[model samples]
Target: MYSRKKGFISRSSRISCTTNEVTGRYSSGHSEDNSNETSNRYLSFRGFFRTAHGSSKLFLGCQNFSSLVGTKSGIEIDSDLDDGFSELEGPTVTGGMLETNVETELVEDDVDGEDVEMPHDKLELSDSESDARKAQVPEELLKAITTAPVQSLDKVMVNWVEKGNDLTRADITIIMFYLRKRHMYWRALQFSEWLELKKQLIFTERDYASHVDLIAKVHSVQKAESYIEKLPKSFRSEAVYRSLLGHCTSKGYTKKAEEIFNKMRDLGFPVTSFACGHLLTLYKQTDKKKIADVLLLMEKENIQQTEFTYRICIDAKGQSNDIAGMEQIFETMKADGMEPKMITKSNMAKHYIFAGLVEKAENVLKQMEGEMHLACRYLLPHYAALKKADDVRRIWQLCEPNARIVECMAAIEAFGNLHKIEEAEAVFDKMSKEGKNITSKHYYPLLRIYASHNMLAKGKDLVKRMSERGCAVGPLACDGLIRLYIKAGEVEKADSILQKAAERRFVKPKVVSYLAMMEEYSKRGDVHNSEKIFYQMRQAGYVRRIRQFRLLIQAYINAKAPCYGIAERMKADDVFPNRTLANMLSKSDPFRKTEASELLLYC
Candidate 1:
């Protein structure tokens, strides 16, 4: 026997033990020594066994068995054992092995000869119980998990689960759906991984497909393919293949996309027009020839071509400079009872422009006038480039009523480029009356007209209006005003305007404004003020051009200052003076004429 506190028997007590084969109990006879009494009392072997009916039983040894030593009946035990085993043993027994028979009788009495059945516990819950478990997810916890940042999602989920919420499969499915719908694919993938790994939830094929799509979108196509390979063969279906093909086409992995497309065909999957359209668009960039093969494949596979398919084919033809091929595709598209989109018409106009067919381009613009405003914008610049002022006006008049701001602005720029001030002013006034918000853009074009035509009063009024409307006057308008002043020979007025514009910071002075001031100062033979303006322009980060350097060198020579250094400065800036400037410099400084001619060589 072992002491309960010490958990092991002490060595002082030595007792001999005998087993009863009949009763399966061990009987220990203790010594009659008082010094070892405590050890004998605490230490004894108890037989441990289980009944046939599966109930556990322990046969404890009698502490004092020496009282039965002289008796032939049975080993004498304590009063509790005597009462408990009275039915199994008589007042006398034959040998010590009879103790085993007695213990077996005790075990049979405890079991009562009854047969036991194993417990059958179900692993899965019923539908009602599952619903109740799903209801255990708190509304607040659900909201927090869905709305939390991706970085903090793990912490939020762990805290919710720790608070005794049962995150079941239904709850996880709902959360994943919400995340994917919101385009939070990365977060959805993370949540799915946590559910399957941490919670031991098994996901179905649809769930796995969602995971694969999220991986493809947030990570890469290669990672998504690796994930698909790891999945069971039954999970790879037509939907999964189509999704992968779509991603490949979007990323421009042309070779990988073709392989997947061919695999789909070999597997007897339906080739969809949407997938074909993406593949064809990819082919349009690198290999126009391959487009026909894809179209032929679609036809052979009985896959219907969409309007977008025809559009891609036409664009491919246009890219290859095959105008006749493009027109043929356009006719075939119309013959199929499909209307061409705005983008298709734009491509046609571009092809016409490439071929220098201005009339045909104008006709296409007119055809698209009521439906699109961008046509006028595209054709206006073309007309301006050809100096066709009448054609520019015609395109402007043909713009739709709902024309965008950029379209109107483009028309105004074209008019300005063609030197048609009246038309430009008319367009500006029309824009203002049509309730279009007149900003700085509208003022700059008209200001150019004013500068070119010497309309000083109008230019000043425009600048004043810009200030009154809380619109900062831009550099273009400032340049126009200063130029108008200089053209009018009002040198002092131009200098004052430049000075005020620079100091006020409402409008920063550009290089054009500085150059105009420098020219005016040079014209008045005020080389000091001219050089001052030139240095200021340089400090403003304006690159020193040959024309501007010529002006400065002329100013230095006219001022009779040391002029040799000007040529050296020009050479350092890589701006060699031209013939007119070289002759002027040679006459001004005859000693350095050869140096100027040599510097001209570097030009």
Candidate 2:
């Protein structure tokens, strides 16, 4: 038997276990007259115990308390209830109260049992947890992770994970990809190391290669080597070695690159064309002999040479001025059913240019018309050097179809230099009509052309338009305007313009503007003003070049003002007078002609 005491269930002494059936119900064998009284006593004890214990359920061994107290008349009391019935009943109740308490405790236990089963139901999910992983990482999360401080990265990742965000292998890979693309290699390495230590991610060969490459780029080659050494032997494959070799070659770590290349060879890894090409390019300038060796090895090993292989070999030969060697390689390249790219054709043109065969260079450029736009900026200067102004114009026209801002600017400058003012103005107008952002660079050439032609009003109008359009007239255009005023013999006007430009802060005058003023003052034999302008240029932090010293020395010598000291001053400023300046000084001052001639030897 069980009885409640101080909110706890305790075993009681044996009680009566008698049953009496009435109307298909079982109950304790009590008199009908006392039935009502006993029922009342039982109900009162049950209510009191419930209020005292605050628990409606109790377990006594394997028997349920509610089963002992059957429904109303069906109640069956234990046979040994008399042992401690008095204690449970107290003064106002009978054994029925003990039975009711047991029944109530059992009811509470059943209700509590239902609560224990709830957790098991929650354990089953509708789908795989991994299936919830996103294909692409969230941009906001990526931005947060990337912008977070290096030390806080772990915390950021942890917080993101704790927020129920699923991070998959693909998501991790995307993060590393962006980090590497942005050259945030150190951060990528840190992320990779964290993933590795956590062991939550399974890294593939590509992932490992990214890590190794980041190590090489962000840390040192020695660390990269250590990382490779620590990698599982299965991960150290040809692709991994090739990635390392490529990094070494790019960084000019020749010895380390060679070691990696040889290690691959000794391990019997197949020599790929990319690997051979990288080594060839690295040694092109420093060691052509190695390039020859690599070419021979490629043939011996039955390795196929791609167009890139031919290009590197050709570049190698060109660097050595081996024009015939380059030509031979070019023929081999064609025989291999490979069409030369712009870079290949450019190399051939370079070879011809080196040999002074301008006609052959022009022919190569003609063949390269489809790709000439990319090379026109450099090619135009070469043509200008050869006195081929028509060729320069032809190249400019060829480049116009796909010309960007830089190409357009280059065309205008080229035309200005060649004195083709109409062509320069036409290009400028086209650029303006196309709505390309016109910066100060676009204004320089046209302003110089107008200034050189003595069209002062037109230049001033252009400056006004520039200001109206919110484009400040920069130092280059201002220098051109000042030079124009100087050329027109409007010295006072030029000085006023310089002062106004300084006052307005539209453009800070550069050394060129001061040099222009000095040249004008020198041409007028105003040595005092020229010297004063030179000193002003110095105060403005202009490092005096040889040309500035030459101009000032000539002006001083022209005025015959202690000109011998100019040579010593030139030496003091580390601006040695060249042959032309020495001759000018010797002729201008015969008294110091011997000293100037002897100083020329030292220079």
Candidate 3:
């Protein structure tokens, strides 16, 4: 079992407290009021500050923690970080707690033949110094981790520690938060695993939840579940289960998510808005009919509705074309003392645009003024839907001077939707000329425009330019390129490009890309290539959905080829066909003619 040290709070609380202290210090130029609070808080070190002769190597070539703490009185080390210091066996100093003290240790200086004072493994820091150091720690760690190559993260962290930097729980909390905010889940998971292996900080439920969430994102939900099972029982709280549930919901595994939800209830954990919100979101996508039941249950449980909860409800109502109902929910949300967030308003406006209620959308956009960087993306598309080219142009102009990347992409889409291909091209050209840090995603809208308009030559040119400019030709680009080739009747070229991309270990084609190829091959009665793509998809570890199987069977029927073991194949893949697929299966059956003849004779 892992150590259950009580001195450490959950990661969230630590971050909140640290943020308050740092904000206070920077705002007032002093954190005198927070000094006592800082002294009482504990900080953990990972055995990188030992002063014993021939002891463990020092971090980053620093002789002691004095440089990090600034002065001897800046920090005070205590022995209460871990209970009994049980892991500090032999000459290795495992971990220590930092609290408040003015006492300093003195040592004889051999060179000067005089006594000198050295800090006692500085843990807690004084007001101004500690707050500044606290703010700086995350910056240094983020720079080190993000700048290094993925394979070198562990070595880089080790080098950082060896440089005599303090590795506290608070630093890890802030770093992980930033890593996740930037969507660097793989690197975040790697950092978490490294921390655990090095026994840096004691793991809490919050840490386990974050780890499980990252594993689900970077690896698989199955792997996440396995990791959860191995977690110490005390750490398997609602947050961990809900993390798994949220991912399952995202993947639309309704049954699995419901099972997790039931497990949460069986464990006697109170169902919060977070758990119900996932359920509502899942049902909103898969089974909108079940949304009412979830909301009713939330009301029955007396759970206070949060912004997310109301947003999902509003979306459900809007999607059902219940404009009045959606407004009512919005009013109820306000009555519950919750103001609508930007995303909530954006979602409502999106539904309004879809419903042809442009005036309502305009009103929502009006409320969102001063946040033009955000609201402009919404406005461009809403105006595009109405074919208001002038309005689209006006909004696109508003995005100038400091337009975000997303707004630029939205403008391209809005222009494309209005069939203003030249305008879209002009926007793209401007982005390129301005050197606006375009990524592969910026290419997608224009590529899609060319594909939809059957401008195969233009699509090919853009893709070539992308390659020449060192932009990544990822799966989405490959998908659009494949569509262009198919539209131009160059099926062979499409297949060749997809195969090359798949052959490269770094680029995995999207499921839609594979499906598009399979569908074209099926239409041509090319059962062999269809089946090849099918198995390649499986080998690539893409989830084998029923749609792929449907396309494969269509290829067999179109070819008049008698497919063998199709039922067994589907069963092995745990994908049973529905009525339409079953009909197709009978048509492709090897013995179907004989069976029909036998039935005729019996009749």
Candidate 4:
């Protein structure tokens, strides 16, 4: 067993810097320490929530990054929420920032010689009657409900249902799906609330799970958990808890994720591979050492590992620079009869290239040559990282014959990384010429290239072109714009972009965008704007990490402003200062000598 005390990161380990020169940002490490004594008992993942013996309700894993959700038009929408939504008011987007609902279907199945209906069967519509009910749906209902104000959603939904239009579960699901696809999470949450209030349908575990997921998206995870408590005990199944766990993992809420995992076991749900896999994913990103604990628990319980489980293990080892350990995991996976997919091979090659094992990476790429058309996107980046411009061109030539939007995107990134700005622009120009169905996704890589090279005029021209083309504006593009203005010393212009984007409720500014502005202000000793953005970030529901506190304190020091309650603020956020931040705090708050002295040991 891993040492329980080792799960918590010491203050000494938190001094690393997160540098992004293109954005003119500096960040202190964001690791969370798990020092609570109560957490030790649950360090092992052996007690996580699992499917009961002979149960039909199996836990569904989170969707893969490349997994596509089918829509009426067959557009492949990304399932990850971090990409943010594009300009919702624009014409129907051919590409960029669309996501789909990947929830498991609520269907009945036979398990252990019994016909078992899944939880949340209330969320499903009868196939035989669905077509008839769908035909009865009012054409105006979706538009009227989704486009209405949050305060008016209830009235609109109620009025539509009372008008005698058949509202089936399928209709409700489609509404939620489209709303989410458009990145109208707030409107979706309102629709869900209206559904819950009507009492027209009895909600099951799946319905509650969907609501909790939406709540976490629109509001905060804390609110989502509170909503869970108010749910009937029967509705709090393994699926519901797993939904909470998945959101927490995505948001990097390590402490809260552990609490939910422990509660799952306390509720008598046995350990399942799905729960363990989530813990592995969480640890892999935040604290790789803790991954061993999860692996141990899986071994002790004899849980059959899935391909995703092996992938996470390989990633954790690769991230830690344990090449031999990573290879061992890959070998073990094959021994267990798990076949690696194309993406898996890409990730392996990526790590190998990062490790400077050029021959090994090339060998892996050779293995992938059979699927070169599909693998070109991955191959281009790997070769680009190796600085092999010829190989990048070679892969492009292969892809050039029938290059899809995704291949073009990879080529842009690869050429940009190689500082082939002209070549990158050439790709963009070709996309425009070939009528490649461009979206904001295609613009971001070139925008990033411009920002990195301080090509302010080019970046501005590109933004104008995007506007002319009606490509959706999203946080990623806005982030690129912010970096461009900051690079040109047009800080106020960058600030204006952030403010205007934030005003659009659907277009939330990225954490990096906020940090870029805050960092610039801090360097100039502009405490007022620094403090303003700091509070804005908090109000935006961003968990304040040590980096924000460090920047805020630096602003106070530069301005020669006396800061009060800095220590209290840090404590409230559970963000303690590292040595560098400790010194900054001492300089900014001279009166708090006692607190400064307490933090100075690291200094």
Candidate 5:
């Protein structure tokens, strides 16, 4: 380090100095130098400032020497910072400001995109060009997605093909297959136009069998036969043959099913367990004994015994009310290393239910809980039939939280249809406490439970809670409120509720709620109120159900009016007699000829 007084830096810079200029830069680091006199080739500040015999005055640049500000400090040289090029050759170091030259070159290097080779501070959050890439999906596939009626897909696909667009049969198959699988069965036919173009390619037995399976799954038995008859010989794979017989068995098509199974056997696919299973179901349903013998013979052939075969056996035992035989099958399954899975337990539950052994059936259901889905299939109906709401709740409690939601919701529906609203609410409360998700199915049942039990206050509280929890309170809940008000004999209140729901843009009222209001009016024997609500129902797009017609018919019969055209229409529309209709007919003495005729065909 070197220092000079701040006011005299220029004067110090003018001090004469001489030394080997190269020594200031590279000479100090010189391990090798080419010179004859080695000591003469080096110079130091001691020799340079010892004496100056030349006119050349050497000074540190003004800016470089400017910071020497002290009278108490002596000028001292301490070497630290060095750029290797500082004194390499014969070039004048004296020029413009020294630090400015270095900054100029640094800026130039930065603009020219060259590395300055200086130690630099690291940068934070530095970004580059590579972050902008996006995912790409094929344009053709995107264009195929349409919200229009599916009938349009077939035409679009045809145009694509005719226009030499690179779409394939596989693409068309995927779209239609998904459509049917998603329960868009009616819409799936629209894709048949596109499918027709690929008929020749897709008409193989395997493809036809797959289509038969699709039809069976969709519950389109009538369509299944029509399509099966139209299929070519190449399209009747083993599965197709089995599906045709399977359909027959399900619909109790014994002769047709047996015929198809026999034909399958003739075609050398006789070893099929599915065909055998259908035969067993046929015999079981009709009380034919030959099914077991035939099934046993096929089993001995060392062919794979499927779960469906055991299912048939279980069904047969249940249908015959053969409890011992069913137990025998359960033992056989265990001995054969087949654990009692949900399907096995479900069969037992079904058998027990038919036998009126509710406790035993419940034990079986609980034992198989979560081991399979559809365990609720047997239990939901059993509880509904027995009016056992607590039984339904117990079964759901034994299920996983997710499975419980699905099962309990189903139970709620079954109970609601039976008008056991209290039972449905009890199950729903359990579901809510169990921390299962609430869905739309749970909504109406919960609302009706509140209404039927005269707990509309609680019901309104539930609706508010649902909104707070971000759950959807659809129109069904509002409709339920309307019925509750009517059933509680607050007709004006019910009307107000309906108006509020409509103004707030709740979904449309369900048909049952409308019918209930109309029925309430009919119970008052008030024709005017019933007709007004009935017309409103029509304007609201509700079709008159059989029950609705019966309600109105009962009111007319109670009036005992002679047949005008209106009364004739009401009589014809009556699906079944209500209490008023029955009472009216009963009042007419048995000797009344018209009343006697009416009683015979009343329902």
Candidate 6:
């Protein structure tokens, strides 16, 4: 409806303003009025005074937690987050959050003191800013793109770069930002072409190395290497080579990485920590003769070796029956006044354990304490595959009170290989009494053990503990919880867990989660949620999953809902969801019940 006398028109959409052609003033509108078309994640972050939200470390460092806006002032911190992760622990990163807050202000209104369209643009890109009362898009993209789906922006970027008419230096930077974000690897080849057109393009040495890092962040290790190749001779610095070499190693390009090591020597770039780590990782994954040849090559090239050079020998001989060689290297390292790293010592211990010299391994474990204790804590589980609980306990005692959660969890996990369920539970029970809150770290392992032991109720209790402790329930625990629900014939509880997994974007709602949910809907014949997820599975791009589809179809049948041709459609497609879902379908399909029915009948 509109006022006809003044010829006024209706205003709509969220944060959308109507422009007056004559005055150029924004027609004021309702912020509350919004539709799904404009419900951007970043926009909602700003509607809450973008400054406060940006400056808060929790929201900045956190992932997928922007949905917490609707909740009251309460944060359910996962034990696995900063609190539990002692390795990356330091003072809470409030400063980064604070900087984000400032960035948020820049978003709401431009620095020039003018109103922009919506609150979503701040999180979007802009080329530059200064103290002014005018807001402009600058005809360029922003850096550090935090968009949800970089894939969605492919068409936009392809059009902009191909035309090359509507662009600025900042625009190119935005291009790099998006390219790196989306890992649009093909775009780099285009960039190389643009560089040829205008010898000096947007990338300078100062930021080129960083751009390489950005590419690595997006998992474009090969692209990162390619960019290094294109860097001009004058601009090709040591920092550039180091970044490329690091990327090569990360991407498992062993041959290219070795070549980079030689190039670094030729360029006379200092062999920093990065160079050592990369070269050593490559040599470790290769043969002993190859590693020896690499060392000789380094010597011939006049490139001095770093302490990590010895790691090659350690990796080669460690955890194997090569006891004599490891002993000789340890003796040489001591004689050379180059302290054998704890890794070397731990590797020696691994050899002892492999050789079944339990007493010698125990002596080595005793001798290795303090910081080295942490390294050995990780090693003990591998060696303890053949040893006893006392050996594991001895190593655990050597570890600092704040040993890595992975290391601690490893000790608990090693129990299964030894068939030590009660002992494993005993450690968990002791940790509980000590008030050491077991999180997802312990949750999955304990759940698996319980399920294997037929202690379904206990597994469910562990999941409940995980939920209450604010531990993120992962797929493993979800499986255990569903199994418990099935054993007790509590299909409803199982379905609820499956639905929870689907809501949180768990990669694949395994047969456990899917089956339990389907069974619940089958027992009650409830097809509403079942069909919704069937569509959700398609929306999530898992439609070929026959198991998931069949679950929905069978649930519909049980509920007397209709899914008449779904079975044929599934088989017409890939006709398989996953193993578990496929099994369920095989059992329930009356027409082709060969696999599932045979298993059911025989079992």
Best candidate, lDDT: 4
Top candidate by TM-score: 4
State the C-alpha lDDT per candidate. 0.55, 0.56, 0.62, 0.64, 0.47, 0.46
Better of 4 and 6 by lDDT: 4
Candidate 4 lDDT, tens digit per residue, 190-209? 88787788875567676787
Off by over 4 Å in 3: 1-151, 166-175, 317-331, 334-337, 352-373, 433-437, 464-469, 500-508, 522-525, 531-603
In angstroms, give how far residue 324 of model 5 lies from its true place: 1.2
Task: Please identify model 4 stretches exceeding 4 Å from their true place.
Answer: 1-166, 199-202, 429-442, 503-507, 521-532, 544-546, 549-572, 575-603
Candidate 1 lDDT over 1-603, as tens digits, reads 112222111122111111222122212323122222222221111111112222111112222211000000000010011222222223342233222211111100000011111111111222333353344444676567655654787888789888887777666655654454333455567777777677547766556656666677667678988988887888777667767776565444555677677666667777677667767765554333345345544654577656688777666556555565567667767766888877678778866777677788768767877664446776776677667888787777768366566677677778877988777777766765674445443566677667777887777776655544433333445556667778777767777666655553111355556777887777666778877887776654343355566677677666776566667777776554545777766756646647667999899
TM-score, cand. 6: 0.43
TM-score of 1: 0.38
In candidate 2, stretches whose alpha carbon ends up further than 4 angstroms from where it belongs are: 1-142, 159-182, 198-201, 371-603
Tens digits of per-residue lDDT, candidate 6, 156-264, equal 4455567775555555555544443333333433453444455535555545665565455344556777767777787777766666666555433454666676666
Candidate 4, residue 409: the lDDT equals 77
Q: How many residue pairs of model 6 clash at the backbone?
A: 10
Clash pairs, model 6 backbone: 54-101, 55-97, 55-98, 55-101, 112-132, 112-133, 125-142, 525-559, 545-577, 546-577
After TM-score superposition, the amount by which residue 294's alpha carbon in candidate 2 deviates from its true location, in angstroms, is 0.9
lDDT of 3 at 362: 78
TM-score of each: 0.38, 0.45, 0.66, 0.69, 0.43, 0.43
Tens-place lDDT digits, model 5, residues 421-464: 66667767777777544533346566666677777677666655
**Tens-digit lDDT track of model 3 for 1-603:** 001121111223322122343333323433122122222111011111111122221100011111000000000111112222111112222222111100111011110111112112111122233343345447767877865654888999999899999998778766775565444565678899999899997877667887887788667778998999998888888888888887676555665777778777767788777778777766665444345446545644777677787787677667656575567668767866888977778778877887889899878877876577667887787778778899899888878667766777788989999999999998888877675455444687898889878898798678666645544454556667777888888898788767765664312555566777889999998989998999887775544366778889889888888889998899876675656788898888887777568889878
